[model samples]
Target chain A: MMTGAAAIAAGGAGSARQPRNAALPAVIFAIFALMPAFAALTAQHYLVDTGTRIIVYAVAAVALDLLVGYGGLISFGQAAFIGLGAYAVGILSAAGIGDALVSLPVAIAVSMAFAWITGVVCIRTKGVYFIMITLAFGQMVYFLATSLAPYGGDNGLTIDARNTIAGWPVLKNDTAFYYFAFLCLLATYLLCRALIASRFGRVLRGTKENATRMAAIGFTVQRFQLIAYVIAGGIGGVSGFLLANSTEFVAPAYMAWQQSGELIVMVILGGVGTLDGAIVGSAVYLLAEEWLSGLTENWQVIFGPFLVLVVLFARGGLIGFCARLRLRHG
Target chain B: MTATLFFVQVLNGLQLGVLLFLIAAGLTLVFGVMDFINLAHGVQYMLGAYLAVAFYGVVGNFLFALIMALLASLAFGLLLEFLVFRHLYERDHLDQVIATFGIILFLNHAVRMVWGAAPLTLPMPDAFTGSVLLAPGQLYPVWRLVIIASGIAVAGGLYLLVTHTRIGMLVRAGATNARMVSALGVNIKRLFMIVFGFGTMLAGFAGVMIAPIISVEPGMGTNILILAFVVIVIGGIGSIRGAFVAALLIGLVDTLGRSFSIDVLRLVMAPSPARTVGPAIASILIYVLMAIVLFLRPAGLFPARGR
Candidate 1:
């Protein structure tokens, strides 16, 4: 798989060496795969639901990593893509089209279309300007959704049931949905990894490192970036579709900037540029969020300083931190 | 009647613009000088409103509470700079964004814990509480006019300071060519602190002034923070003049857009759809403007660091 080369692709841009070992990613995936059975054994039915939720968000986080980590494009609007995807499903289901056959493509297409249109304008700006513009566009999505009176407005829309898989009632079972989401996550992971290892991925990496130099060497940097942006949006759409199914509801809050920030936080927490780190990061973040909120209502007070400390100390996120730990013991 | 309403909306826009300048002034200065992105800057504005309310509860004098709150928020900003932000100045933008974002979460929640989630209020001072007649059947609140005057006064004062003073020269120099200024033996760290403190104080001042009109609550900074970001991006990073112009432009555009979007849309479409589309467009009017500005001028309208 040329693990070192792929890690270097992400590492060199972040200026932090991404560990090349496949162990961490495998372990995380193993845990994800075993989650439903573990939940059933423990009789904690909600654990399956939690596992499904994590898988859904992890999908979005991975796509976000494709942007922030691999491409060096810090889009603060990833959640807007997710919102577009979910709304596609929600709106379609309301129109009596509840089959995945119809909703899936609609969800993915709408998000990609949005990503393409916004990417054209967004890729023109750089640095903080890029962040602000993405955020502004995300806000545009949020306000638009809130004004959707027919679709429930500020309160959000509800789907009565899961979308049928080709007219088969396959996704109605919680266990089935869990595996369904797990498979989707796997597909997204493999797709992102494949993308990062391809020539297109290499050019994106080259552009990230030195766009001017790449441009000098005859690469249309913005066009490549726009494509990556659109692809990531498509993946975010997948996450949103899963999320809508799991919750059976979608709201304007799906597109909120805060949700976008959390996705970025999740990517950073796992270790930017590590595709599996995105999955690990969201799982860790959401689990911690659940546990902490249980103990204290003002959990953010503890969590906030914790994030500050992580930024100050954890240079390459949890993955980097663990690599250093292994080296120390070795 | 239509003319008076339009005039009133213009003043409302100017008022909103003035408040934005207060927040953006500090944001642009810190960003321009330190090259640090403080996502928590909005919380500083929220803290200002909260502190003002607390001080008013104790002191019972609007003027005294305002001064005390500004000083308190300034001190707090300095404390944050000393503790967390100073370390992040040398870090990458990603780390800076995360750390400050964490601070925003902390403060917004901490404020919730302390003040409760319910919105609080700061009453207008008795003297300025009255409304002044603008025209027949048109009366405007005097406090809003005070906000505009004070905002302009701050802008004028900042202009003089940047143009005339030695420290201001260092700030301008720092913004344009920071490394060069540092090589010439200026204590850049101290300069950063001074600018950061001043910016924080201005944000706090704006919050105090506006607290009377709006409900003071947790996470108030989040929404306004986005607006401040928009203002700075449009105005050009590191340019106070840019902030002033962009702030007013956004304020007027946003306010008037919200007020008249439906009427404008009605001209091109049926009233029913127009009613639905108007608010959505109005909400994004500034963003659309931001996109247009970025498309035409990627570096912003007034790039202070002239390439």
Candidate 2:
């Protein structure tokens, strides 16, 4: 059932292709890549910070889409992995292992281990239960972090310095880190695109559409889904790493369920199951939040209703809304 | 720990358990009947407490305030159902979660805007103000006793309603298969409204009742909501009896663990290490219990749905 869904999705991709618009996303990305440089040149430090946040969260949102949209796994604990990654960096740096190479692997390993254990129990459930169980696991992790009094606990940990690459302060400079993040985002996009097109990806997508049929066809549905979850988790961990460095602090609040909900909003607001949509969603979401907060302290009072309207009226989110408009115009 | 301290905490745990049962009962029923997960159910609880406070300010009588609060909560819940929840019944769990989460955000902030960010307190009724001595040097408050007695009574009443009443049969039937009940000309929509409204009221009732003892504040319901979810999952969804039992178990375990975890750990390890490890373990005890339950019985201890 899922294999057929994949084929149909692939067919849609082919039919929906427009030659002129093929490079639109790339052009948009290039503009985004240059945003920080423009900010730095203009001496807009706050802009640089906001841009870095967008890139980091965008990376996490894209990873989230891979699991929720493509793989049919709705996780409410993506922030847990991100927090784990952030904590990995913090704990290691505190222990004097401040190298990017060491910290990155440690983050990935910690997140992967957590995902493996939690995903085992979480995968057995489906639908609403799946969402809640994932949430419960996330809360469990948050509480554990809060109890770590030795490492700041509820007060959170502060990094002494940003991570260095081979003992050079390559990542400390705002422009360099922004460019590094952009490169990572680009690589992540390409890698996710490749993975989704592979034979493995096909099987994974199959399980999402119809697990029973896929199982009947002798595919190990659980294994594929688990791999997808781990991959998503690892990517989320990368987002945490960026977030910690960006904020210069890591807290249990990073993994709270509210953060997870915001990540999902980013996924849906962009349009689910689309790689580019994740980036678009993140950019739109974070920008709107930043803009709204500037307008009022209680921006969510208005934003909440706006979200309800979006979910009800806009089926496929902003991308779908735009697509409909263009079709009518065309 | 002294026996008096132990006994006092146990009673406290029981009281907490009862409040959880009231909230969880309605939650599990809604899920069982509609196949819906309402994260905003906690907001209903918060609203209940807020309404109680408002009503009390007007009537200045505990009974009048309680009744008004319950009615207000029912109306608010039905309003939400009519406006937002009705559209979501057919949607996936993710959509339900997100929409409900949005509701939580809106309501929490709205309450803050109206009630301020500080915790609000409902004064205990003068009639239930004094303490009754349970043991030597152990005096428990009358209001807490009232909560315990009322919670158990409600639980008993619910058991009777579900097992022996005509509506109970329909509820059980609905839990098993909602479509089948609808096919039987049971007016599933009306049933849904009753179940939803009743659940909302129960949660609200819990909030109002506990307001005097605990801080009545914005976002007060979120943590408790998660705890209620754990109870329903452990008790087996759709089972009132399961919710009742699970709520008590969790209340006892969590309350007792928080109080005695360090003491328990001290027997096996040094005091310093125990102090650190104790609180962490106590916080996670319910989850560990849940994991164990899931391993043994994935559907929970008494699932409404059969194998």
Candidate 3:
């Protein structure tokens, strides 16, 4: 059942030997690490703000790749966990509790709890049904957020101040917050890389490659998938926590299906299953979106066809395309 | 609830159900036959409303506008199939989902560009303009009843078309096993085009029928599109019967839950908490139903593919 395009995309370190550019990830990180300096040099505070947003989304997209690319789970509800995380911060803060130590754990725990409950139900189905059920769950969360009037409901809630880190307002400074987000992104990426190279990762990838075979070999496929889903949800929660702090606002729109779709697009565009690719995809997508919308309000009219053409012609996404180009030239 | 109010709600629920069925019928058929997930299906419904409005401006008659809209929708759908979707049928579901999502984004924005961002409306036809008495002092809008009638009629017609005709047989066989059907000398591509076109038209039809009541706006399809997906999932993918039953059930549950959840909750909980929780619960009721259905029957109620 493996198509040529899928085969090419799935050829991460496991199948094909690399072309000896292992420093690609380090280079990307180095670039991100130096972005703040670049922003400072350019004296563009908006660039830092936009970079922080990209880093936050990159964290979410990387987590999604863990499920979609490696675990063979296409969850349309990943944004729900992010929303849960953000709402945890917003609700606790609104109730006069703005400590990151308390709110961060609550955010992660709540999202994981949701992931566990919904994952248990969602893992029962496969293929299109899985996609639809995840979407249903996401919409349910979105509506729940809209109905929470005490927390500002559909109008959304704005925090008076960002979460204090151990009674310190280190995050109140924009540069400091950007660095914090960058660190979170780095941690998330490294964590994903480690997870994908572990015994657990091997089993998850094996199940993805052939679930029936894994089942026949006495592996409970659902358990591994559920664990992966929960892990992804936790990471998504972390991103959500950062997102709330970044904007100092939490809205139901954060968990809208469109956001989920954009996350999926990021994964696909960056080359699904590729951790660094997800990061790059987020950067490209957000930057393009910001740049294009500035050009015309109807930018999606152009962006949409571009996506279609990419899916049609660019089988493996940007990373895949880069790989092909290197192979041709080198 | 009062009997009249309950009856009126039920009619509203039925109207909503029929509209869902019209959208889901085509959606499920495409999924069943081609295994293609068209996220753009909702935009087709939006297009239908927009086309109806455009045609109405020219024809100045609702009936003629409806016919022209349907025809235009069919042609537009076929064009999309020819241009974009035709290449996607062979790709995986992820590819189909992404490509169709792109179509959704394009069309939604395209409509906004062409029609402006303002909400547009079509007046109810003169023939179905007023309210009709169902019981003493229980009057309902004639147009809503008309929508319900037409939806049911479309469903009945779809049932006949899917069950009786040669194309229907091919569709059934394809849903059961596409490769087997194609191997039997069936032109799967042509079958796919036909199925895609019909699904697009049904979605458009639902949009046109509901346009008079709801504001015709850009991105109108995205909300209902999700509902249709829920219906298809609950009904069981690839099963028209499943879609019909699920759509109506969802319509009733969603409508009734929203209308009476607070009252229902107040009996067990305090009024304040009930008020806060009721709408949230009501909005998620169908999704909860879907989760339960999937847990109970993973393949859905009437899975076209055998267990």
Candidate 4:
């Protein structure tokens, strides 16, 4: 599968020397499979919990990269769908359906519906106009959350308990939930890798390079892009579900434009379009944020300038920078 | 509400519009001339307020503090343009957007670190302390009236500079086509800096003036920045006249909607329901207006070019 995907990626490569890429799913699964024993050896509950959160975000970040990196759609409202997913679980639990099976589908359905509605208008514009429109839509949802009187409004809604699966009591334990999240992350990575390597993914990548050329080739560009948008939104919803469950709280702030911005930063910081890069990026970003905030409440004062430097000086993000160093040494 | 209250709100709206116009002027000019979509422009406004507070602390005189603050803001804008923004001109809009957004994050938080997240206030000068009767029974703040007057004065000055002066003609040319202006031997880099710096100062001045009334705090400019974008979009990007008209229009609609939306709704519905729904709908009015304007005129109301 790795060789096959690499061959497909090579078909588009103009350069003679194709970059040696490792298969990401196998790498991630092997590490996560070892996570439990490692946690046991280390006696660290914090590691397991933090690791679970990172995997959740990694899933969402990869989904976001598919749209932003490959489809040329820069959405600053990805969190809107993530929050939608989380709220799906919370709202359902409140109404007496606390099963993960029911809540997950509800989350996916809600996210798809949101993507369809927002993507319709958003897809019409390109460039800066596109950015602002998506942002406004995100704000509209944020306001909707704030206005929701029954589900806690600005204060936020708290879950009654962690979601259960078929009366197994699997997710009641932190270690079990950690593995559950890890499994979801692994599934998402494989699904995304397959999607990006599929024939449809080729068309999407071509459209990103030059939409006019792709359209001229008889592709229904908007439909393809919209489909991609829905997929990303659905995946983002999964992360939101994980987040809501992890914290057992859902708030409008979770879907704020700023959160969307941070998600974008995470995607770019990792290496936009690289599946493994998303995981690495989310880990780096979340950890940096956690450590920095602990160090100083004004962590953003330092983080902000760091981002500017990354944008101004660095190209292709942390992954790209590492790849460059490898070439220089190798 | 009394006639005077209505009149005062109208005056208040105009004053707000004036401040918006000041910020929008530079934004329009930068967009028109440089074709740069700057997310960091709001930080310039935030910096202006912060600078004014700092200057007031140092000078202890309102007028001198404002003058020095404006200059400081202008200098900072020029410095940023020189250092960071100039590199972005040849890049894609996505890269520019990302870079500027980074600046916004840095500056908003930087201000918080410096100002301690607590809202600061600028003292109103002794001369403009009292209210004057606007209509038979309505007393309005004299300081607000000064704001309206000064805003108009600055607008007039900007108009003259852009239209009648040599540099202004060059700026007009630059707005239409930066390449053509450069081809004509104008120092385009200098012009960009001057335009950006001036725009930055105007945003800052608007911030300084409003700092007396509104709380000077971090993230204050974020909401206003979005509102300014709406104004410029409606007014047509790159057109100062359009910004002025659109700013006033937004000011009136927003202020009036906030004031009478409930009453207007009450006329047709139950008072209790109207009271609850009116404010929510009122808050959404400008965004709805923006969506409508975008639908009708995608480029904007007064697009710089006919296209």
Candidate 5:
């Protein structure tokens, strides 16, 4: 019904969206690949840290875009999946299992298991109910994390060390960890783009537009969404794994509803439905947090109204705005 | 737990229930009638308490402070409606969520700016002070009973207003289908304003009433706001009756669960495991209940007529 400005935001390679801006992803990834080198030259090691954080969150953002943008499944519980992922790493590391081989699979499997179970329930509800239920589930997961006193509970758990890659301490190096994160982001972006281009993706997108029609066409709408949800959750787990390793800590706060909200903000900030938008949105949001908070302690006071102004005027987010500008200039 | 102790817990649950209902009533109506998701509604609640504290300082009268605080809350709600929410009625739910989330951020911090980051307090009136002996050793506070009675009165008054009034009829019809009512020559915008303002006042009222019992602090409403959402969802989006039932149910379950989860777990499990698992289960008990309810009744307990 709302096939107006919002539908435009729900863009793909070939739909009602603007011309395929393939160069955008290339530019973004190239920038990501070179950031560490730039940091080396500039002697801003913190820039590497910021870049790694951006990459880790970008993976989750890409996953979130798959649901909120492509599928019209807005799960407010994205942070829960991330939390589950992070905690998997934290718990394993605390148990003296610091290898990625064990921790990585454990993280993805745990979050996917959580995703599958919750998605079974979450996919049944539609629209606002979906949002609320996901939120409720996210809160449940957050509370569980807070209650785990053995693994540090509310205080969160600090890893003894960064994860080793197959008996080698590759990720122990800051530069290597940054590259690992960048690789994860790259892989996630490509994987999602491939998925979206498949027939399954088309069916998922179809359900978003009109579920009744898709049902009539003999597609199991719920199955497609549930798979997408689980996939998104796995990606969230991967993000969580990196998040834990990068910081060498995991906390229940990582799964706070506010974190989920911020992830949504990242999705919308770049423009939803587009993987390119997801990455850009993550970089921009994290950068803003880094830059703005440095300006003053009360940066959100300014950020809050700025967000309002953005929603009021910037319909398609930063990426959409840029597209609009380019079109106007053309 | 002893019978008297259980009874005390039930009363406490009732107190929580009525407080939740007061917040949920406004929240459910706005959501039902307007289909707006105002995350900032919690801050409006916080605003109510803060305003009451500020007014009490000036007026030095609890009743007068409550009245002034309510009026101020209504005014502020209308202002927010005019400035922000009025434009968002046509947008989808995601946009509504983001915009309101921004308001929550602004308001929570704005609150800190106005009142320092430290928690503030409002003294209870002398009239409601002291405890009444309900049994041989059970002494219940008078103020809690007052909160319970007042909450019941508000709920009853709300029920009457919604069932018997012209505005009530419009609201019910609007919840069923807003566009149809708008098309039928009713001023849906005005109806929205009334609902929003009234909802704001109800949240504020809850804030004012509970101020004496709980510390008034920044971001205090975030957690309770979540509970209110849980209430409205379980009760059904647009049904006041559902909200009442769900709120009280949640109040009881949550209160009782926290009080007895350890004991309940101890019966079937080892004491060490029970002690460790008890608080965790207690905290998530309401969510578990909500998940079960959603699985059973996706639309909620008493969804208003259409949606």
Candidate 6:
């Protein structure tokens, strides 16, 4: 799994040379896995809840990183998939269908369908055009969600209960739900890791570097990008499913362009091209948000400048910044 | 009644187009000249409205408040450019987007802190408070006409500035090839600041103009910002003419779509379903148009850059 060729293909070689880089992901996961115990010791249920939220966002951010960081597709509409996933569960639950098996697949299928259609139009344009088109599609989804009056519309819909695995409320327990979200995050991270190392991933990366060259090499770049977009949208649906179950609510706000922007910010904050960076970035961002909002109603004033500083100073985000430190010391 | 509604909506659409052009002109110029994406541009518009409110409190004259707000908005925009944006011109688009987004977040919250969350209003100038009859039983606001006129004036002024002036030639050249313009010994930095300041003032002017009609509030710029983005994208990123055409096109389409979508939908579907689906379709109409445009002309109707 740690072969030289695979590492290079994964864009991991530069970071792989740094010894601390090898252990960072394992350390991050260990921290997450033990977070339940830490929460129990402190008797802070809020920690577990917030932790669950962070992990769920990490899942979306990782999926986003696949398209944005790896494929150079700065999709400003990833939240639409997340919204679709939540709405799938919300709509199904409203109809008295609470089975995870049924709703989760429906969510993914719906999101993929959306991604397929929108990605086709979006991938036709590049640079700023790509960003705006994705945003438009996202807005379209948001407006559609708000118009869904029967399913609660702009006010949002609350689920009576979480999705049951084969009619068993296994996720009813907080720790169980936390581990479930953790597992989902781990699976998504590994899947992205594997995807980026495959031949398909190489072609995607090649296109990001130079689409014309990729086309010259006989890869229909748009087809590959569209496939990547659909894959990301499906994974985003997973996060949305988890989110709806975790919070037991879904609203048009979930799919707003702001949410999509936050997802992109998470990827950038973590380090755009690094898979582990996405997870770390999501954790840092959400935790800071929770902490800041607790401190002041005007938390964005602080958070906004923080983001500007990050962009100005922290070139590669937390992960990149850390790697740079290692290079300097070593 | 139908004809009256149609006439009123067209005027409303044109009014909306004029406002959008004011914002989009600056946005397109900044994008064209510097290749910088400023998500906070909408905040400048919001700031303009807010400034007009505060200045009105001090100056006690609408015209004076308007001038003061424009100057303040220009200064504030230039300050931001000098402090934050100037550093980001050479960075990735994502970085520019994120950094500017941060500015938006900061300012929106900061404005909320200063002014409170409640939406404030600017009084319509006394000179233009009255309505004029277009026909029998059809009247339109004079202030709106003033907006349309002022927008046309600004567009005309910008056309002269960009096409006939030396600075305008440099801006056009920079949009087409910044590196070449820089190599030719033009002070690209000064040019960026000038372009940025002018664009900011345009957005602010739009804000002040519309403030009397709409509520002045923090985050009011967000939706308009999205609409402005839609304008520039459809207009082609760097072309002022494209922005003007696309802005009006969008304005008419959106206004007409929202007003008539239900009527059109009723022709094809049952009334209840039509009522429910109408607003949703209307809201998405511009995006659908954008998709079609991108599908047909990937670059836009009037791309400034050479393909």
Candidate lDDT (C-alpha), each: 0.90, 0.84, 0.89, 0.81, 0.89, 0.90
Candidate 1, A5: how far from true, in Å?
23
Candidate 4 segments exceeding 4 Å error: A1-20, A23-37, B1-4, B267-276
Instruction: Give every collision pair in model 2.
Output: A2-A206
Better of 5 and 6 by TM-score: 5
Off by over 4 Å in 3: A1-21
- Tens digits of per-residue lDDT for model 4, B196-277: 9999999999999888888899999988888888788788878888899999988888898889889899999998777666
For model 2, residues B119-226, the per-residue Cα lDDT tens digits are 888888899989998887778999999999989999999999999999999999988888778998899988988899999999999988998888889999998998
Model 5: lDDT of residue A71: 92
Overall local distance difference test of candidate 2:
0.84
Candidate 5's DockQ = 0.55
Model 6 stretches with alpha carbons more than 4 Å out: A1-20
Please report the candidate that would top lDDT against the real structure. Answer: 6
Per-residue lDDT over B104-125 for candidate 5, one digit per residue giving the tens place of the 0 to 100 score: 8888988887788999999999
What is candidate 3's CA lDDT for residue B210?
97
Candidate 1: TM-score, chain B only: 0.99
Candidate 1 global TM-score: 0.97
Note the residue pairs that clash in candidate 3.
none
Kept native contacts, fraction for each prediction? 0.65, 0.35, 0.68, 0.32, 0.54, 0.69
* Model 2 residue B68 distance off true place after TM-score fit, in angstroms: 0.7
Tell me the deviation in Å of residue A232 in model 4.
Answer: 2.0
Q: Which is the winner by lDDT between candidate 4 and candidate 6? A: 6
lDDT of 1 at B275: 91
Which pairs clash in model 1?
Answer: none
Model 5, retained fraction of real contacts?
A: 0.54
Identify the leading candidate in terms of DockQ: 3
Chain B, TM-score, each prediction? 0.99, 0.98, 0.98, 0.97, 0.98, 0.99
How good is the docking of model 3, as DockQ? 0.58
Please, what are the lDDT tens digits per residue for candidate 6 over residues B74-146?
9999999999999988777878888998999999999999999999999988999999998897889999999
Q: Which stretches of candidate 5 lie over 4 Å from their true place?
A: A1-16
The CAPRI-style docking tier of model 4 reads: acceptable
